[model samples]
Target: MQTISSCVEAIVLEQPFLEEALSKGIINYSALADVLQDDVSQTLGKPVKAGAIMMALRRYKDRLTVSKPYYGLNALLEQLGDITLRSNLSDFTFRNSNTLIDSQAAILNTIKNKSHIFYTFTRGILESNIIISSSEKEAVLESFKNENCIALKENLSAISLVLPKHNTKVAGLYYQILKRLAWQNVSLYEVISTTNEFTIVVEDTFVDSAFSIIKNLNKN
Candidate 1:
């Protein structure tokens, strides 16, 4: 027995992307109400009028906008620390298997002495994408050869942005950062996120522009 008010609140809270759209004033309320009425009716196992849903949405808009935590780009920019750019890097991907275990160890050992840039172990069901980096292409190739790798891509680069620890409860912090980059048509290769830090990997060509774009997020 969910009322229209409760249903609207639930929808807004549950969907971050939708909430973002609403916050940015990009959503058509009447169209959204029509869409949500059906979803609400399905969830409640009862009929809901689109007009009623629209009224509820209008009533809740101000409260929801105010209650939701807004992490402004300017504030986030203040938390941004040093930016590191690396070039002459390479990426290696291997199919996931128990046999690749030894190859993983060998790859780690090879980079132990060399000055490498970035490494990520992304595991998947069908296959695994292991991306590692080094200044020397030969060093990367020599280390993982007998390991049955699927692909080796060279001349890749990475830019690491140091970020301060953010409160987990806050919403839209990462999205805000990503939105700026997306708007500028900067393609992200990989994103590494930890509790206290976030890193984005992109091609060497986009490094300066990306850095400038992110750095400007702090501007008034």
Candidate 2:
């Protein structure tokens, strides 16, 4: 754990831009000290002493605040701001060949298989991967099996619960959860959101642990 002062110095060192803000008295030094301690303590998983906090304050006194308080914006943004929510909780499901429906129908149906395609709809038109304009469900179904078109198979080993937006509050929530996973040495392959959902593909082995973590998060 960082002392109150060490945390301040760390913040200043991490974000050099904050120095100018401090000189102009835009930030209250005491408040800045308190916020850093509170935030970092949670991250470091231990109580931060005030003396170390004061040391950090003096160390970065010259470059304390440039525009605003510099806590851990980079760390939080790196983890949280990238998430996109394409589909809601209802949109995710597993599919199997026995019950594979047209891409459009699959949007509402949950099938179980290793391979599946996810489709997004806009104004009754399938704008994303389902590309062709179909007059009816049968036509839409035919488009998927069309020999002229190249079909991409999506494989899901593990599911990622994407948040709708990447606001400060939501970012904080993900950062905390992701940090725990990182500590356990989990690797994540993330797909950035062009649509609504932020997707993270993890190995099948970690699904149970990941789900447990999420379930615990929900309880809190």
Candidate 3:
């Protein structure tokens, strides 16, 4: 049931850079097809002609370029609201376990009185990530002492954005913002976002540059 076209799409989609290059029509389709012929043939359990793969690549490129309209996305970027930075943040990751919630709850309960403290949690299937003020590093470690610590990083800062209302209705909003940051070579440790709030965490050194890049993303 796996056709050459489907295989080509699956392979290209796995690599975002390739998909982007193809969308911009920067890649040589025939050359790419030749490169992909082996993978495609192997995936299909048979040999496929490079010309056939090339045709499939062309069709996929057409769809990718046509479907990624950024008209609404542009307007959304132009409407970004206040930008703020929080320094001296620490990042922690722990494997998910039944008691992970209890450990997180303890941290929150302890920080509740400190209205100025910054804290956020993102729970994944395999692990949970916690970002908190570095001042509270000891507290977090003690609370999560029993948990399996996967990683811990300090000397980082977070830059958060206040997005315009109805930002979710626009397509590729995050991609546009992140693309600009990527162009400037800003290294992002993590990206966190809510419906109307977007935040990026980077090392202390990159915060100012990242802030500047995002603040002027809409300017001509």
Weakest ten-residue segment in model 3 by summed lDDT: 65-74
Off by over 4 Å in 2: 1-8, 11-116, 119-156, 162-171, 194-196
Worst 10 contiguous positions by lDDT, candidate 2: 84-93
Q: Quote the positional error of residue 139 for candidate 3 in Å.
A: 5.0
- Cα error, candidate 2, residue 141 (Å): 20
Clashes of each: 0, 24, 0
C-alpha lDDT score of every prediction, in listed order: 0.71, 0.45, 0.91
TM-score against native, each model: 0.72, 0.33, 0.75
Regions of candidate 3 where Cα sits further than 4 Å from its true position: 93-114, 123-129, 138-151, 178-186
- Predicted candidate 2 versus true structure: per-residue lDDT over 117-162, tens digit per residue: 3333332122233321121234444434422232322322334454
For model 3, residues 20-130, the per-residue Cα lDDT tens digits are 789888999889999999999999999899999999999998898778775677787788899989999999999999999999999999999999999999999899999
**Model 3 deviation from the true structure expressed as Cα RMSD, one decimal place:** 3.5
Steric clash count of candidate 2: 24
TM-score of 1: 0.72
